[model samples]
Target: MAAPETRWLAVNGAKCRVRTKGTGRPIGFLAGLDGALTWTPFLERLAGERQVIVASLPGFAGSNGHDRLDQHLDWLLATEELLRGAGLAGADLIGSSVGGALAADVAAVWPGLVRKLALIAPFGLYDEGEPTFDVFAVRPGTLQNHVCANPENFAQATAQPAGEDAMEWQVTQLRTNEAAARLLWPLGDTRLALRLPRLTTETLLVWGADDRVVPPSYAGRFQKLIKGKTTIATIAGAGHLAELDAPDAVAAAILEFLG
Candidate 1:
């Protein structure tokens, strides 16, 4: 039971901060679009089971970068370098939301870098002709309404006890949701969605059964598309962020799938 280590490293000159905890076969946990790793219970569960390395994507958390540094594809390269820096060659990868697309893209391009894959309610999967909700037009009440559908998990996430400023911070997460959208051409436009079928690693797709953001129907699409020995597991009463909805359930599902 080693203590978690926090350190910084640079990939292609982009500075990335990695939080590593526990010990065993290395596994990387990626954050979604809004970029925050506040899921202590979930991360602790994984850290206790394996050597966990949570990589902060550049410009999202504490990571910093400069102009001309394209983040989407660059993040894949950065991930490979980060794994190597941690003395890891191949690892189990789990990604949520925006992170899922990153994970899938990485698995497709560097097929040997990943041992298995888990995508939790990933974004960037919409078809070219499909319509998407504009993040900008999403009212706070609407966001909270959709998110709070899973009351138990939503409470766990917002945990906005009396004066914790949790609601304000959530507003921040909701507001900045467009940063990733601005970076990527559009969900599924980069061709990774089309290339999902090309991945050779065993894959696990987890979607919130009641997801409003990226409808559960997309889970069927992922099941039908990815070429790997992929398995899709749906978490009930969860919205887009299944981790926040039911971290324990999501973590358990991941443990079963990855193990």
Candidate 2:
């Protein structure tokens, strides 16, 4: 299957890099780590099932420190406009990590716009006792290490022959952390924990069985709290970056639920 047709689209004070793939059914992609979406594999698997539009989303790297998108809610609003610009205003929402939090906000604010929502080991809940990963405070190495418990993925990413583009990405990752820390969740409630009760759209919750980042325990909370029908699936042999680790499973689950 062909990869999502990536493009550069503008949205409220920010020119977003958006990827539009497939055309039958529309589902928005929200990245978790680094904002540069890693949905290529999933896109390939689900190419025939539905249309997938992944947004690079306005952030610390591609963004220019605009005061308007400083608040998390504002970014969510702007993101919806970005999606609508990509011809996906009422499409299903697929959010991973930070994107999950944004997805929840969108469902809350525009209750009728979302057809369905999918969250894959998303962040932002900030459980009181469960260890919280401060995406900004950690070292780059630490972040990489946490991505895969096997440690091979980190070695693979680090060992891949270095190139000018890879170096640029590393720099972007480092700088974006600081800016993201400020605007990512300044208003708190990144999990939309309190707002789940009001969500009226059907949701599919995907989690990696080995996911130590958000932990599978939170799945129950998400399932129980959402007012809408929620289906849960666990992907084995996977960690936080399930799309990269187990893209096939992720794609199948998404296609089965959304298609």
Off by over 4 Å in 2: 1-4, 37-39, 60-68, 150-167, 175-180, 183-188
Flag regions of model 1 displaced more than 4 Å: 1-3, 86-88, 128-130, 140-179, 185-188
Error of 2 at 204 (Å): 0.7
Provide the lDDT at 88 for model 2: 67
C-alpha TM-scores of all predictions = 0.81, 0.84
lDDT of each residue in 1-259, candidate 1, tens digit only: 3446888888668677688888788888777644643445667788878988877665555465523346556656765676666554588988887778777777877778789989987766675444444434555545544543464554454344355476666544543354455445444344566678788889899987877766777777777878889889998877777877767888899989988
| lDDT value for model 1 | 0.69
Global lDDT scores for all candidate models: 0.69, 0.68
Candidate 2 lDDT score relative to the true structure = 0.68
Expressed as tens digits, the lDDT of each residue in 1-259 for candidate 2 is 4445667766786666777766687777777664542334555565557777776666533443334566666777776777678776788888876677777667867787788888887665666677545555556477766665455654453342335387766655654555455545442346477778888889999987887767788788788878999999888988776765777988888778886
